[model samples]
Target: MLTEEEKNAGLVGRIIPINIEEQMKTAYIDYSMSVIVSRALPDVRDGLKPVHRRILYDMSAELNLSSDKPTRKSARIVGDVLGKFHPHGDSSVYDAMVRLAQEWSMRYPLVDGQGNFGSMDGDSPAAMRYTEARMKKITDEVMADIEKETIDWTLNFDDTIPEPTVLPTKIPLLLVNGASGIAVGMATNMAPHNLCEVVDACCAYIDNPEIECEELLQYVKGPDFPTGGLIYGYDGVREALLTGRGRVMMRARTEIEHTASGRECIVITEIPYMVNKAEMIKKIADLINDKKIEGISYINDESDRNGLRIIIILKQDAVASVVLNTLYKNTPLQTSFAVNNIALVKGRPMLLNLRELIRHFVEHRHDVVVRRTRFDLRKAEERLHIVQGLLIAQDNIDEIVHIIRSSQTPDAAKERMMERFGLSDLQSAAIIDMRLRALTGLERGKLDAEREELEKRIAYFREVLASRDEQMRVIREELIEMKEKYGDERRTEIIYASEEFNPEDFYADEDMVITMSHMGYIKRTPLAEYRTQHRGGVGVKGSATRDEDFIEHIYVASMHATMMFFTEKGRCYWLKVYDIPEGTRSSKGRAIQNLI
Candidate 1:
C-alpha cells in the first residue's frame, strides 16, 4: 500500500546505513540542553520562567498597580495570561498564581493580591474572575527598571512574543523567596525566606561581595517559611545551600484550650507547609474510626474566611499532651522538606554546594551592576554632548534658530552649529541647546561642570568594573576556606540534638540471674539467698509438694546464658538464653535450687 517515494525512503535505511552512535550522541546533547534551559536555570532578569512571569505581568497590566482602581477579578487575569502568554489551561495558571499570593505558601509573596487567595488549609482559590488580584508595592519596585532596557529579552516558545530573558530584580529572588521544580532527571527545592532578612542579605552582599558563607549566615539565620514552623538546626541549612541537597524537619504548633464545659481542645494555628487541610481532616477521622484515639469527642477544621482556626475537640478532662504527642508521632504534623537541586549557572545544570550557590549569586549581582552602570554611562554621555552643543550656540540664538528653521532637517542645524561654534559634534549639540535656552554665560559654565561630573562618574564606574574580577576571586577563596572549615557531609535526614548526656547511667552495673528451660523464656533468681530459700520452701507443711510446684522469676542481665532448674513441685523445666525484654525491672525473689 506504500507509495513509490515512501518505499524508496524506507529502503534507503537498509541500503545506506547511518551511524547509530553519532545519532545517539546528538540526541543526548539536545535532551541535556532542553533540561538546562527549560527547567534548571532561572533567568537572571525576571527571576521567573515563562509561566510565572507571564502570570504576574498579566495581572499587573490588567490591574494597573499605580491606579487607585479596585482589584480586578483573578479569573480574568488568568484567562489573559493563558490566552496571550502561557499556553496552559486557565485552571493551572490561576491555581499557581493563587498559591503565590497565599502568605502561608510563600515566605515573601511577590504579589500583595487581595481577596480569598485561599489559605494554608489547602483550600483552592475560586475561579479566575471570582477572586481578584493586583501587584504588590515590592513587585512593582522590583520590576520598575525592566522597561528601561535594564535586562535582556528572548522570544517565547512559539517565537511570536518577546519575554524578558531575566528579571532585573534588585533583590536575589532565589535567596529570598526560593523556588522548587522538577525536570527530567533533575529537580530543585529551596525553602522560602523572610523579605526583610533577604533584603539585609542583599545589602551585605553589596557591602562586602567577598563575604564567606558563614559570614553570610550572619544575615540569613535560616529559611523563614511563611508557615511559622521552627527549623531544628543550622547544619542542614548550610548543607542545602552548599551542596543543593539536605533535609529539614518541620512540626505543627498546637495549643491546649479549655472550654466553659470543662472539655479540652487542641487549637492548631499553624500547619506544615504543603500539607493538605482536607486530607489531614480525613486522616484524623480515620484515626478516630480505627479507635487509635480513645476518649475523644470530635475533630473540626473550623477554618473560616479570615484564617486557619482548626480545633480538635476532646472528651472532658482528656490529656492534651498525649493527644499532641500522638499527632506528632502518626500524622503529617511533623514533616520534612528535602532540598537537592539548584538554579544558578545559566544554560547549565550544576549541583550547587552552599558556598557555590552564594558565590554564583554574588557574581551575577556584580554582572547586573556592571550592566546597569554601563547603561547609565551611555545616557550621561549623550546628555553631556547635547548640553555642550547648546552652550556653544548661546550667543547666536537667532542665527541658530534661523538655521534650524531654514534647514530641512535637525542634522543640518547640528552641522551648522558645529561649524559656527568651532565645536566637535558632541560639543556642538550641547551648545545648540543653550542657544535655545538664551543662557550664554551660566549655561556655558553649567555645561563645563556637568561634563566634569559625568567624566568622574564614568571613571568611578570603570574602577568598580576593574576591581570586580579580583573581588570575585577573593570571595571565592574565602568561601573555599569556610567550606573546608565547616563543610560536613550529611549522614542522616533527621537532625540530632547536639547536647551531650552522661553515659554513666547507661553503663551502671546491675545484678542479674539466669534460668535455663527447653522452651523460649528466661527466668532469673536472686543471687543473695539461693541456698537458704530452697530449704525454707522444702519444709513447708500441708503445702503443695516441692516436686509438684513450678515457678518463674524476672531477670536483668547485660549478657545472655542458659540454665536448667527443677521446680519445688518436682517438675523439671529448662529455659533458653535470651536478653531481658525492654522496659522490665528486676525482681527481688530467691533463686530456686532443686526439686523435692
Candidate 2:
C-alpha cells in the first residue's frame, strides 16, 4: 500500500517503490486467466474454443455459407472471422476451420470443404486461397434459434458489432466431438464419442437427472474414436467417466493373413485415434532397421481413399503372433490416450465427469428454449393483436372504407379508425395500412384462420416458458430428432481386460525337447529337429558336454509349459520353456545358473 504522499508523488510523475515479485505474480495470474477463459479452453455447453466458434459464426451469419449455398473461398471466411470476431492470426483461424471439415479428425464433421483439406497421414491442407468451405447440413443445429434472441450477445473487439456469447447447439457437441487444449499450467484431452450414444446418455439424464455414472455407461459404453481401433479395457474408461481423468489403452486393429506363397502376414485395418498413419509406419520402419523389433520382412502402406491398410510381411521362420506383439510394444501401433475433461463452466475452468457434462448441456438447452419461447410468444401476441383488429375491420368493411376515404390523409384515417373501433395505435395503423383486397370474403376467412392459429401458438409458447417440464420435453424431442438424423454406430471397439492374462499367451505353442548335462548345463531344441528312429537305431546326440559330464535329464514340453528346478538348498526356480535358449545338436548347452 502506498502512503498519501507517495500516491500523490506517483500521480505527479515521481516513481514509487513497489515489490517486483508482487507485480509479477499479479501480472501472471491475469495472463493465465485470460488464456484459460478466452483462448485455450472450450465452453462446456457448446464444446467449442473461441476460435472455432468465431469461424462458424462468421461463416454462417456473416458470409451466409449455408449447406445449400455455394461455398466462399476459405480466405474470405478467415478474413471476416479475424476482422469481426476473432482477432487472431489467419493461420490459426484457417487451421481450426480446416480441422472442422476433416472427417478423420472430427467424429462428425461440421464443415464441408471443396478443395484439399488434408488427410490422416498428417498432411497439411492447401492454402486458404485455394480452398472453399461452407457449413455442413448438421451445423444448422448449432446455429438454430441464434437470431431469435435465444442467447446473450456481447460487442466484438472494437465494439462495433455484436456477437453471441455462445451458440444454441441442440447437440451435446462437447461429448460428440471432444476438445483438447493447453493452458498455463494445465491441459485438456477429451475423447470423442458416437452421436447416438452421447444423445442417448444425455436424454437418459434429462429423464433422470440423478442417474449415476454407472448407469450412463450403459448408453455411452466408451469413446467412439473416428479412427477405429481397439480400447483394451474398461477400467480406465470407467475412471474417466466417473472421475474426469484416466488413461485408456488404444491398439490398432489387425488380422493375420496368408500370402499366395503360404507365408503369414499381419494386416492392420485401423489405427488408434489421432495417431498419424505415415508417422506410425515410419516409426515401425526405424525400429526394424535399428533391430529394436525383428521378424518383419517388409511393410506396405496400402492406405488410400478407400481405407487404411498396412501390411507387415514376416520372414519364413518367424512367428506372426510374436512379431505382432513386438510391433505393438515398440511402435505407435499400441498407444494410451489420457482423458482430461477440462472446460470452461461459466467463465471458469472446471474438471467435469460424464454426468456433469450431460447435465450442463441440458441446462444450456433449457435456457435457450425458454428464451426462444419468450421471443416467439411476444411475436405471436403482437400478430394476434393485429389479426383481431383486421377481423373487426372486415366485419365493418364498408364503414371502415368510408372512414378511410373520407379522411384527408393517412394519419386522419388512422385516428378515425381508432376512435370507431376502440383499437390501439398499432391496431389502428395496421387497419389503415390494410389493402383493399383484404376486405374480400376470401381474405377475411384467412384472417380468421391465422388468428386462431396464432392464439394456439401463443398459448403453447407461454406454457413452455412457464413450465420447466415443457422446456425439457422440447429439448428431448429435438435431441431425439438430431439423433435419428445424424447418429451412427460406434467406430471404436472396447474389450474387457481379464486379470489372469499371461504375456506368454502371445508366443507360439509348440513342443520342444529339453536336455540337461550332469554339469548343470541346459538347452532346448524344436521337437521336429529330432527325427523318428527305430529302437535299435543309435539316438542322435542332443547336446555336447565336457569330457567328464554326461546327460542327466531329458524331457518334452510345450513352449508355453512352465518348468520348475529345485536346488539342493531347498530353493525353487520357475521358467517358461520358450525362455530357454535353442541350440543345435552339436552345440554346447548354456549354463544352468544362467538359464534359471
Q: Estimate each model's TM-score.
A: 0.69, 0.92
Q: Could you tell me which 10 consecutive residues in candidate 1 have the lowest summed lDDT?
A: 499-508
Q: For model 2, how does the per-residue alpha-carbon lDDT over 190-264 read when each residue is reduced to its tens digit?
A: 999999998899899989999998899999888899999999888998899999999988999999999999999
After superposing candidate 1 on the true structure, give the runs of residues whose Cα lies further than 4 Å from its correct spot: 1-36, 39-47, 57-85, 158-161, 198-218, 232-235, 401-414, 423-596
Candidate 1 lDDT by residue in tens digits, 542-592:
111134333344344432343455755887765433323221223322223
Go through the candidates in order and give each one's C-alpha lDDT.
Answer: 0.61, 0.91
On lDDT, the leading prediction is 2
* Residue 297 in candidate 2, Cα distance off native in Å: 1.8
- In TM-score terms, candidate 2 sits at 0.92
- Deviating ranges (above 4 Å) for candidate 2: 1-13, 498-501, 513-521, 527-556, 582-590
